[model samples]
Target: MSVQTEINLSQVVVRQSQKWQQLALGLLCMASISSPQYVWTLLTKPLLARLDVHLPVLQVTFSLLIIFQTFLSPLQGKLIDRFGAQRFIGIGTLLTGASWIGAAYSQSIWSLYLLYGVVGGLGTGIVYIGVVGQVMRWFPQQRGFAAGMVAAGYGMGAIITTLPIANSLASHGLTQTLVEFGVGFALVGWFASRGLRPAPNTDPIPSATLTTGRHYTPSKMLKHPLFWLLFFMMACMSTSGLMVTSQLAGFASEVGVSQVVIWGMAALPLAMSLDRLTNGLTRPLFGWVSDRIGRENTMFVAFALEAAAMTLWLTFRHDPLLFIVLSGVVFLGWGEIFSLFPATLTDTFGSQHATSNYGWLYMSQGVGSILGGPLAALLYQTSHGWVPVFSVAIGLDILTALLAVVILKPWRKRFLQH
Candidate 1:
């Protein structure tokens, strides 16, 4: 072989290795930050016991966490875009860890609200949007699959910690567990953040796979009706998913299945662990499917699946074994929005200013958190059952599914035409 050809092959190998390294680091950073949200349901009983609060009032903490995480993402995204990923992500992870450590010492619910809700939200928000937006820029050719992998880390990261945290809550108590794990997460995430670098400059792949070839800034994108439609659809999807996420443990106990043993393990933790697996799996699964079938088509299928799974879940909720299994199914149908929406957004709006644009869209999840976390709890308090809450979620899922196909696809096509 010629020396020139060998040099070219060597460069290709180096590039491939670098890409995978960045991907792995991004995944680690995502997983490191996931626990505050994903494991929150597990924390509720202990928090309620410690704080002596009403259910809806306690839920406000969760709403605050998500509200801050998502609401501030635009500003966070802009900063990451300007000052670079490593500095912001490092600071974000430290804040996230500090939130947990502070929560460990917090005696009052209000203090917990400030520490776990506001601080944790800001920290995780910076890491979450920063990492996902970075992934969007890095893998322009494979945004769906790449975003899915990192989002999967965030979705499924809790699986490893759920059992440990549950066991710790049983033995060591919440305070010790929070401090120990918080420190570990902070260190690991900060170290991983150092490894992240901006995407390298490359010539645009001519008329790349599905992108509109027209870049839209956050300001320009905000004016379009289609953006609002997509926002509404995402908010619906987020509401369904976050409702289950934040309310799972509460609803299980309410239904008298929380303590029931399924396969020698308590049903709630088993369901939560399984839900994480399915949640993580679905991001990539649906993302890959969307790459082939188109985003709206994939949305219709996944959203309909969630609606159907929710119906079965609500129907057979009293059966502990079925409850555990269907919770996974419910998430399987729901979690892909994390992957699909960002990919679709970058595809439509263009990757220039992708992070900032997604930050604005990410705020929709904050809306879902409010509706799903506090309002849903209040609905339960008033209605005296889980049926009403689940029914509303199911309706949103079906409506969003229909909108994806009937409205979004054609509207996007027309918008792109001009």
Candidate 2:
């Protein structure tokens, strides 16, 4: 009954509540990421077949999805800053569920474009920013790993859904399968979005007081040369990865691989899942390394590995084992960028508005996604193979590496001061 004892009990209760909130947020993160992948299997083929559309035109729907996400993510971030997470995620989830169901009944390509491309993409954009921003807020001390875990869910969700959706499409027909996906997404997203609430009375923690003394405002961070360099680095990195992801099945077919084998290999979702899982685990480690060794140093290693992996693919395209190994490496390196970039943003820009700032940084991924497939397709058409295409990708990796070293120099002193 003592006043001191009451204070201690209140503190314990607060800590416990925060822990449960974090747990719920993490689960929400996983569900938010996974929901989109339900449609990946039907991205081109099933829809194209059912709707009787040309491949190129059908692919435009995919591009529209990326375009929507690209243009809307920053806006969503601003909304998150204004309204907080719970409301944004809840409304977004509702829209996303409706879009998916509408997509299932599309009688024309334009309808698909409207439903999946515009509505679904916009819905995802809102939820994506909400979940990721909330994670960063909840785990300011572990932003890199926290952000990576949420982002990784996006990749891993695709992996988890690929086989099941593919199987469903094969057996149940596209419309039914999508209908089921819509229902599932609606139910899960509703519960998950409702679970997302910000930690009470939390303020942005400055890195200076912590082990890493780096922070910047979005406007100020934009002034730094290194921010643009890192931004472009991520853009190109995304271009390379998405090119491969979107074209994996086609690539297998072009190389004279069997349909059964191609379908089996299409399970790059396994590789994708591993890539994301590794990213979640390694992000904090790399952040620690960046804190210790330096961000540029960590980036140098990532770009080098990425370039090397791409080279392996070019050299041994015929060997399935080598292809898978190289693909895995490529995905792993891609995950590193996702893991490191947000932390780098936090380091360069102040955490006062880190969520919004990083959201703009993430828009680079949408740009890359928009360009990646089309670029690869165009290059493949012109070159008659992936050889030329991958060569260009390698060049991009090299360019990113050089830029990272040059642009990050000014921050080197600041980083070392820590």
Candidate 3:
């Protein structure tokens, strides 16, 4: 073979190796950050007793963390783009871990808000958006599947630690558990963050698969109508998942669902365990499907499944067995948003500024947290039932599913042409 051909093959091999390494590192970073948001449900009861507050009051912290994570992401994204992922994640790890340590020592509800809500939010946001951007840049060809896997890490990462955290709250107490795990989260996240680096630059492939050949800056992408539609759709999707995430433990107790035990495990913890598995699996599973079908097509099926799952969940919510099973189904349908939307946005707008562009899109999740967290808690307070809340979530899920095909697909195609 010619020396030139050998050199080209070597370059391809090197690039391939880098992509896989970056992907794995991103997944580890995601796992390191997962417990803060994902396991917040397990901490709610103890926090309420310790802080002596009503449920709605305590939920504000959850909303604040999401708010900080997402509302500040555009800035965080720009910084990551400018400074590099390693430094960004290093700082994030310190904040992420320290928030838990701080929360461990916190005596008041307000202090928890400052620690987990504000500081933790910023930390996780940096790592979350940064890793996603890395995945998109590395696998422009398989953006959906690539983003799905890393997002799955965030979704499923808690699986390994969920039962342990629950057990610790019972055995060791929340304070010690938070302090110990906080240190672990920081060390693990920092280790993973150091490995993160941007994908090497390359010319656009001659057979490029991007629907739009044009690259839009974050500001321009925000101005586009399609972006707003996706934003609203995202808010809907996020709300459904967030409501289940933040309110399930309390809501289950109210209805006496948590009292029931199946196979010697409490219903709430068992459901949470199953939800973690399904949530993590759905991202990559549907993302791989989208690579073959289409983003909107996959969105339709997944969102519809969530709507159906919510419907069934509400219908049989009184039954602990069905409740645990359906909660998993709900998460299975909903978790793919992290993968699909970022991949779709990168596909639509090009990866030149994917991190920043997604930063703007990421804010919709904060909006969902407000709608789903404290607000949903308030709704339950007023109506004194889960029916009204579930009804609203089911409606949003169905609406987004329809919009995906009817609006997103055609509009995306036309936008690309222009």
Candidate 4:
């Protein structure tokens, strides 16, 4: 072989290695963002006990976190588009770490709000857009799977951190635990962010897909009816999942289950772990399924399954076995929403601007998060029961299913055909 051809092959090998590195980085970025969920239980308990706050009041922290994610995502999306992922990841990771450290020293809810809710949430949002955008760029053909893997890391990170955080809280106080997590996450995330790099000009496949006639800017996308329908569907789906996750233990107790059963239900994290795993697996599976069966069909199946899961939960509240089964079903179906939406959006608007579009799509999740906590709290307070909360969730899922069937059908046909 000619020396020039050998050199070209060597360069190709290097580029392939770099892409794999980027994928690993994307996974780490997700893990860092997700690690906080495990810490949620720990923080709430200690803050309420030590600071003498009530659960309802302390729960506002979650709302603040969601609100930060909603507002910060668009800004992070724009930054990633202009400056690329590396700088955003670096600075964002640093801020994430600093926020943890600050949280450790927090003596009041306001201090925790400024640290955990604002700074940490913003940091996660920044890294989130960068990692997701980088992964999508790396795997244009396998966007769903790639997005799934990245998102799954976030879920899995919670599983990985839960035991450690739980153990740490038992041995060390909250302050010390926060310090450790803050420093560790920052260091790990900073190194991981270093792996992100802009796609080379030669990486032209995704760009070509964009040029093939369907492209919509953010404003243009908003003008389309399909976008709002999907947006509301996403928001509703997320609200259901978040409500269940945040209130699982409380609901279990309210149903007259023993304290032992309540603690056993901590196994809900294990369920959530499974949910994340299935989420990663399903994205590629569902995305591929959408390619064949159609995106609308795939979403129809997902939402229908979700509605059934919620209904089952309401019906079987007293049955542990059935509740577990329904919980798994709900999480699996919920996972599909995260996995499929990006692929659907990319198909509609084109992958060239997918990160920004999906970033906005993710804000719907933030909106759900903001609403889920207070809504569930209010429902539980007024009804003095869990049944009403689950009932409302079922209605939302059914509405989402209807919208998917009617509105999303035509949108998918128009956008995904080419």
What is the C-alpha local distance difference test score of each model?
0.90, 0.67, 0.90, 0.73
Runs of candidate 4 exceeding 4 Å displacement: 1-15, 202-213, 256-285, 415-418
Each candidate structure's count of clashing pairs = 0, 4, 0, 0
Clashes of 2: 4
- Give the per-residue lDDT of model 1 (tens digit) for 103-170: 99999999999999999999999998998888887777778888888999899988989999999999
- Candidate 1 global TM-score: 0.97
* Residue 194's lDDT in candidate 2: 70
* Residue 74 accuracy (lDDT) in model 4: 70
TM-score of each: 0.97, 0.86, 0.98, 0.89
lDDT of 1: 0.90
Q: How many residue pairs of model 4 clash at the backbone? A: 0
Clashing pairs in 2: 215-349, 215-350, 216-349, 216-350
Lowest lDDT sum, 10 consecutive residues, model 1, at 201-210
The candidate that wins on TM-score is 3
